[model samples]
Target: MYQYDLIDKEFLADRSAEFRGQVARRLSGELTEDQFKPLRLMNGLYLQLHAYMLRVAIPYGSLNSTQARRLAQIARDFDKGYGHFTTRQNIQFNWIKLKDAPEILDKLAEVDLHAIQTSGNCIRNTTSDPYAGATAEEVDDPRVWSEVIRQWSTLHPEFSFLPRKFKIAITASAKDRTAAKVHDIGLMLRKGRDGTLGFEVIVGGGQGRTPYVGPTINEFLPTDRLLSYLEAVLRVYNRHGRRDNIYKARIKILVAALGAEEFARQVDEEWAKIDAARADLPTAELARIRAAFAKTPFETLPARSDAFETAKANDAAFARFVRNNVKPHKQPGYAIVEVSLKAQEQTPGDASAQQLEVVADLAERFSLNDLRVTHAQNLVLPHVKLDDLPTVFATLQASNLATPNIDLVSDIIACPGLDYCALANARAIPVAQDIARQFADLDRAEKVGELKIKISGCINACGHHHVAHIGILGVDKKGEEFYQLSLGGSGAEDASIGKILGPALPADKVATAVDQLVGAYLNVRNDGERFLDTYRRVGLEPFKEAVYAQAD
Candidate 1:
């Protein structure tokens, strides 16, 4: 993880002091709610339907044990006893008090964490593959570049307030764990024919009311010129992006209005004017950032762990957990363990203070003090030793974190919808909880196999329903909550937007509708076919017919 230098520390202190003064003024009646809206938003504070919500950025989803402990402390002291991990790999404390906002920021700064750019129309946290340095599949650690983007984008004078909020995700692996296709700028690190590293740049991808899979603006951009190219792209958007209408303010909208070819042409023209030498990072600075993410020290060991194998053989519960939560790691004797926050009938992406502390302790004791927050709203102990699997699993089980459902039907991704957000139309968390409870049976859930069900409260798509295999979008039908279902969406290497199935069903019918879709999939699926594969092969008609037929 990148450690904060004196300059970084000083900057945060200044920002915290400024916000403290702002909050005091607001509380003193000098500033109205409308007057303080933008100021609060700039600090990642939102006045939700119930109370204030504070979002804390976890850059590239990286967190040290110390930082994780600090987050748990904040959950316990300032807000509720839990925090919600978001789709962007950030954490949100939903039940925050406005008076404590500045104090929370100060606490976060102590651990080199902050909530800046987590809201408002600026580049949000630059996310990357959660298994960045731990996986062998990636060309290099994508976090190195993500950190570079963070430093460059944070409080940049020129692009501070764009048409709308922008997001960037990078991945070095061909598997696309970062959902690169659904970001404002998706950078895929790859080696060229000459063996020089560069990026395949995808632009204009986003999900909201108007969803788009960003087009490839540049097929190959050298690593050295990343900043210059990004600058060019943003400059084009800043100059020509829609600002008159809030609905069509995103860069994706601009990219859509102008054809991809014309957009590429304008970016190229803009790139020619900027001096690459001035815009790009110096060689020394790049090396410094790369050094911060250097490989973790590991003991020499054989490929297989006898203890791990024995534990799996002896304990059926442990075996199930290994099959679901344990992922392959680059190190010979280590495994990447995903701790699911979506326990049965609980809110997705939420962790209690005790659960967070347990994870922090586990990371410190067994995983070299390194932790990662996945875009799927789960935690990753990226370097747990194979021999420590039993201990880790036992601790997680005790903490209620061991929900053997990674990428399973019950492992849902849902946003804090009408439960908290002022922008929401209907409740997403309840729908998600109901569906999770419906599929709580492990045998049945495992039988369903590798299904991703994402739910969004409204058209903003914060829950990323546009790219889920089975998407549920909550809507209001004459003041009653209803859900519109979509199928075959994926946020992966094979990125595609899901098509809507039929009319919206009432909230009560959603879980049943999802069950019908799953049953239809199981009936028609060929040998070894997952839900997505079956859906792709059979198309939407079969599943749509099954869901609506049952509803009727």
Candidate 2:
């Protein structure tokens, strides 16, 4: 994890002080709600349906134990007893009081965390592979580049306010764990023909009402010219992107209008004008950032752990947990453990203050004081030793955090919809909870295997429903809530938008409709075919027929 320097500390302190004065003026009746809206939004505060919500950015989804502990403290002291981990790998406090917002920011700054650029039409958190440093499949740790982008983008004078909010995701691995293709700028670190690692830059990809899988603007860009190239891309968007209509303000919309070839050509033209040496990070500065994420010290041990194997053999629950939550790590005797926040009948992506504390403690004790928040709305202990599995599992089980359902049907990704958001048309959390309860049986859920069900409250696609294997978009039908179901979507290496099945079903029927779709998939699937594979092979007819037929 990157440590905050004096400059970072001083910048945060000044920002916090400025916000404190702003909040005081608002409270003193000098500023109306309308007058304070933009100011609050700039600090990642939103006025939701129920109360104020504050979003804290977790840059590249990286958190040290100290930072995690501060987040838990914020949850306990300022807002509700729990916080929601969002699809962007940030955390949101749904029940925040306006008066406490500045204080919370101050607290966050103490741990090198803040809510800046979490909202209001700027580059949000630069998300990356959660397993960045721990996975063997990666070319190099993506976080180093993510941090470089973060430093460059944070409060940049030229691109501070664009046509709309922008997102960027990077991945060093061949597998697309960060859903890079769905971002405005997706950078894949790969080897060029000369065998030197560089970025394959894709631009204009986004979800929301008008979804697009961003096109490859540059097939291979040298690592040294990353900032210069990004500057060119942003400059093009800033100059030509739509600003007249809020609906079509995204860079994706601009990209669509110009076409990928024209867009790339313009970017290249813009790139030619900029000084690459000045724009790109110096080699020494890059080395400083890279050194901050040095490999964790590990004891030499055998590849397999006898204690872990024995625990799995003796305890069925532990065995199931290992199968579901434990992921392969680069180190011989270490494992990457995913902590699923979506337990049966609970809201997905929410963790209580105590649960957060538990995770922080676990990370400090077993995982080199590091934790990662995933885009799937889960927390990861990135370097747990194989021998510590039983102890970690036991602690998680006690805290109701051991929900052996990673990538399973019950492991849903949903946004805080009508329950909190003012922009929501329907309640996404309840629908997710109901469906999760329906598949509460672990045996049945495991059989359903590797199914990603993403639900969005509206067309903004905050929940990333467009890329889910089973995507549910909640819509307003008359005065009631109806869900539009889509199938065969994926956010993986094979990225594709899902096709809608039929008419939107009422909220009550959504779970049953999902059940029908799953049943249809199970009936038609061949040997070792997952739901996505079956849906792709068979197309939408079978699932559509099954769902609508049952409705009729």
Candidate 3:
């Protein structure tokens, strides 16, 4: 993990002190709610339906054990006993009190973490692959660039207030675990034929009321010109992006209005005028940042571990967990273990204070004191020894973090929805909970195979429902809550927008309809095909017919 430099520490401390004063003013009536709204939002505070929500940035989804422990402390001492991890690879405390807000910020500063840029119209947290350095297919670690961009954009005066919120996600892996296509700016690190590293810049991708897969603006941008080219792209959007209508304010809208070719030409024209040498990082600084993320030490060993094999042979439950939760790592004898936060009937992406502490302890023991937060709402111990799998599994089980449902339907991604969010038109957590109960059987979920069910309370698409294998969006129809369904959406390398099945169904029928969709896939699926593969092969008619056939 990148340690905060002296300047970074001073910046956060100063920001925290300033927020403390702002909070005092708000509480003393010196600042009205209207006056404080933008100020609070700049600091990642939101006034939700029930209470204030505080989102804290976990840069590039990377955290050390110490930082993890601090998050656990925040959950225990400040808000409710748990916090929800968001699809943006950030965490939210949903019940923060106005009085305690500054204190929480100050505490977060102690651990080199803060809520800066977590909300507001400014560039939000930069995210990357959870398996970045550990994965085999990456040409370069995306975190190095993510951190560089993080430093550059933290408080850039030029682009502070864009037309809308901006997001950047980077991925170096062959598979797109970070949903690169659904972000405002997506950077894929790659190596050229000559073996020089660079980025493939994709722009104007986003999901909300409208969803789009960002088109490639530059097929291959030299690594040294990354920041300069990015500045050029942002300059184009910042100048032309709409402000009259908030709905049409995002860069995606601008990109859509102007065809991709014209958009690329504008960015190229802008890039041609700027001096890349001035915008690019110096060689020494780049080396320093890259050194900060060098691969951790690993002992030379055989690809497979005898103890791990023996344990898998002995315990069927452990074997099942290994099959579902453990992933292959770049190192020969290491594995990446995913700690599923979506326990049965629990809110997806939520972890109790105790559960956080348990993960911190486990990471310290088996993962080089480092952990990662996945966009899928799970935690990863990225460097666990294969032999430690059994002990880690047991510890996770004790803490209610080992559900063995990594990519299953029950491992849902749901937003705070109507339960806590004022923007929500209907409840999302309840629907997620109902679906989890409907598919509680582990055997049944495994049979379903790699199903992704994402739910959002509204069209904001915070839950990323647009890219799930099965998507549920809640809407208010004549003051009654109803849910809409979409199928065959995927967030992988071959990203595709899910197509809506039909008209919305009552909230009560959502679980049954999902069951029907699953059954329909099962009935038609060929041997060894997952729900998504089968859906792509068979199309939506079969599933749509099954879901609406019993509609009253």
lDDT of each: 0.94, 0.93, 0.92
> What TM-scores do the predictions have?
0.99, 0.99, 0.99
| lDDT for model 1 | 0.94
Query: Runs in model 2 with CA error above 4 Å?
Result: none
TM-score of 1: 0.99
Candidate 3 lDDT for residue 453? 96
The reply for model 1, stretches above 4 Å from the true place, is none
Candidate 2 per-residue lDDT, tens place, 1-552, comes to 788899999999899999999999999999999999999999999999989999999999999888988998999998778999998899999999989999999999998999999998888899999998999999989999999999999999988999899999999999988999989999999987788989999999999989988899998999989999999999999999889999899999999999999999999999999997889889999999999888577778789999999999999999999999999998899999999999877789999999999999999999999999999999999999999999999999999999999999989999998888889999999999989988888999898888999999999999999999999999998889999999988888789999998899899999988899889989999989999999989999999999887667
Candidate 3 similarity to native, TM-score? 0.99
- Model 3 clashing residue pairs (backbone): none
Question: Cα RMSD (Å) between model 1 and the true structure?
Answer: 0.8
Please give, for residues 135-165, the per-residue lDDT of candidate 3 as tens digits. 8989989999999999889999988999999
Each candidate: RMSD: 0.8, 0.8, 0.9
Clash count per candidate: 0, 0, 0
> Model 3, 89: alpha-carbon shift in Å?
0.7
lDDT score, residue 232, model 3? 91
